[model samples]
Target: MRLLLKKKSVVLAVLLLVGGLYLINHSDFLMAGLSRSPEIHPSELTWQGQLLVSKESWVDRGQYLPLNVSYQLLAGAPATEQRYLSIGISSVNRKKGSYLISTLQSIFSMSSSEERSSMVVVVLLADFDTGWRMATLKDIKTTFALELEQGQLVVIHVPLEFYPPITGLKRNYNDAPERVTFRSKQNLDYAFLIHYCAGLGQYYLQLEDDISCAKNFLSSIRNRVAEQEKQKVTWATLEFSVLGYIGKLYKSGHLPLLARFLFLFYQEMPCDWLLTHFKLVMTQKATILFKPSLFQHMGTFSSFQGRHNKLKDKDFDDGFYTNPVAEVFSNISTYQKNFPNLAWDAGEAFFWGLSPVKGSYLTVVFKEPAVVTWIFVETGSGTKDLLQSAQVELGHDVVTTGKDKSCKDFQSVGAIENGKFEMQEVDKKYSSASKCLRILVTATQKHWVIIRKIRVTTKQSAPRQE
Candidate 1:
């Protein structure tokens, strides 16, 4: 009886052990599901169909005037030692010249008076006739009377008769088939204007006649400029709008080269296409592009007949789903702390550093794993250890530490501009399951590196696994 009882006890112990092991393994699988957050795949936040571009040009520019003699100075902005200049080019043949009014109006409405006051709004008159241009100038003088008198409004007339004729521009109309619609001449027009206003101020803004702007665009420009200086990266241009060549900003110093480049390639490609290619000609890649596009393309009418303006019907919505700035970055590796803290948002000051030992970086952590589309890094102008080179890496399934931790594991951002900030748009969106973005300051030499602003734009979505 004792033997039987002992055997029963042994059997009971074995059964209990097996039951405990089973529960342990199964519970862990169930718990994992409960803890996991819903994954919003990057694929889900994408566009379908052919991508679109906005190409608006004055179709009648070729038949009319000489750019040189025609570049008549209608009005000049009051000179007050302004640091920047916003240029708006108005051509002939468009309706009402309402773009001139709207561009200036938007500037006044969104930016501070001081900023508006400092900007020189040069409206180029490339109309079909002198009468039309004169009439339009009269309308502008009357409408922007205050600005005109204050030296904030400038109107220039570049009539066909006096301006230089389209000469020396080599072309492959087949490249930009739109050349059939006089798109090549339109390209030349932009080249001339950009060259014309090349060194008018410390900075030149490429403002179009038929584009609308976001609120605080001026502030955005100013902030970006300041950040670039603070961040200490050598940059070339600050691109405001992603649609075509509407709101492109350039360093006055680089204008001559850029303008000349446009001159050489005017006939080969559209102005918008020229912008990206032009960057490659010089920097091997395009400069920083502002996300959530500060300026939107609103023109529905195509400047080139038969080619309708398709910016309105983009296959996907390209607005920024994430804010350019965040309150604080989570799981930062290390940062330089001093007066004037790092600016994570667009308007803030910047993050400055000096003698950062090897492997120092500014990290941006998100609440959940996300797909990052862009990272805008603006460096400040300081002499010590300026960020000469850098690399950006995305982390997935990581906590404070991340996988793929080497600079080689990341991508190299192109050359930094001298005494300015550089913006790098990811060619392809990066998905991070760990929800962290690591910007490794992999290279810096001499002087302090000032990162005035580091903006990480992300979509709060990720792909989940079984």
Candidate 2:
């Protein structure tokens, strides 16, 4: 009897715990925790509060900072005027590849001359190592000589005065755990670079020293931002990459204010952690993330001491170098002609927006009924932009003015948000109903879908993917 009672009591306790977890997850309890977070609507900020933050009383000052940093402007000049975007990269002791030069090359290679001149690469040689500093400068001077002379690559030598003067507060958490400090000086470095390059570009793009960009990454960003604007959404920061602050694109206008906000918490948190609080206090807008990650962290070695490092995303590394696309058909659907100016071309191998109207799809008409063996498709670049279900319809003939009154069985394709969307080979090859087949798409949302490349294969002919 005693044993039975004990067992029953334990079971009841477990049930109560599970019920509590369910309520917390599914009900208003979590909202209580959310309410305490710092996010505030943009309208809630007052001019006085935005402008005036007393630095003296807010936090403890940083200590054991670099005494002096030898100043060197190896290349480029200040922004002539506020440009479209400013990419701020902190090239610390990344003993890996020529991430600095290669990143610049990657940008310039993908971009047209006009696009290249539209923004500036603010490279901050921010480290205390003398040898690394000089080598970094020499390399930048040699590799990007033209960009340096053309004012496209702006390299700045960060000095001791740029940081808070020597104080008692800890700056490295690993070195001094008892006092208030950060994981690494990197938090301070980003704060320094972001503030320094605030007025340089209309929008500031935070990039890591050891990172690679995706193919047409900038174009992707421009399209995403423009789409959000079209939808009248107020976004906080647009994240181009998945890693913490890396790939985070901030409006240069907002960066100045955001930089000021971080100045108050400089000693307490990591740059990324600081961003969370900063977003809470400053704006209610949510951060926009780029799918498949535009920027990839290549540095295996951590710049900070006593830390383990791993790939930001172990599965996804595809971008400018490896991202390949197959050929697409020239014919887009003639039925739905919306946003014709920003029309999607099969050969363009990029973004395509859809209309809110149901049955909005892109179709290609084949000369003969395609005995489709395998169909390859790269869908939306975002979470919601992905197709929920794509109806693969095939028909040889159809009525134009009136309904054909024939129900067609089509292959329904579905997908999760994988970097590149490739559907499985159908159980059996699909032959067109009459002679033409249509890829009828149903979107999860009205956002654009990126059909980078679609290759259809048949038994008789080669797959025309490329």
Q: What is the C-alpha lDDT of each candidate?
A: 0.54, 0.54
CA deviation > 4 Å runs, candidate 1: 1-70, 77-82, 95-98, 161-181, 284-286, 312-466
Global CA lDDT computed for model 2:
0.54
Give one digit per residue, the lDDT tens place, for model 1 in 1-466: 9999999999999999999999998895545423433322232221111101111112122322222212445555435444477575756565322345544555555566777766777666655465666666665665568778877776664435332335444455544344522555666666656655544567788867665556567767778788777976657667777666777787766665665566666566677777777677656443776665677554445555523464732321223212433224422223445332244543444665564444666565555655554455556665543566655566544333343222223434443454333232232333333344555655545556666655443434554352
- In model 2, the worst 10-residue window by lDDT is 45-54
Residue 233 lDDT in candidate 1: 64
Model 2 per-residue lDDT tens digits across residues 1-466: 9999999999999999999899978775344323322222233221111111112222212312212222345456765666677888887664433345555655655566777778788887776666676676776676568777887887765545445533456555544653343333566667656766656766778887656556566677778778877977666677767677778887665664565556556667677878877666656456666676777664446555424467675423352432112112322232243322122233333535543234655444444443443445555555554545555554433223242222233345434235244332231334332333344544444544444545443323322231
Q: What value does the lDDT take at residue 111 in candidate 1? A: 60
> What are the C-alpha RMSDs, in order, of all predicted structures?
32.4, 22.4
Candidate 1 Cα deviation (angstroms), residue 278: 2.4
**Candidate 2 wrongly placed segments (more than 4 Å):** 1-72, 94-98, 165-184, 306-308, 314-466
Question: What is the Å distance of residue 74 in model 1 from its true position?
Answer: 2.2
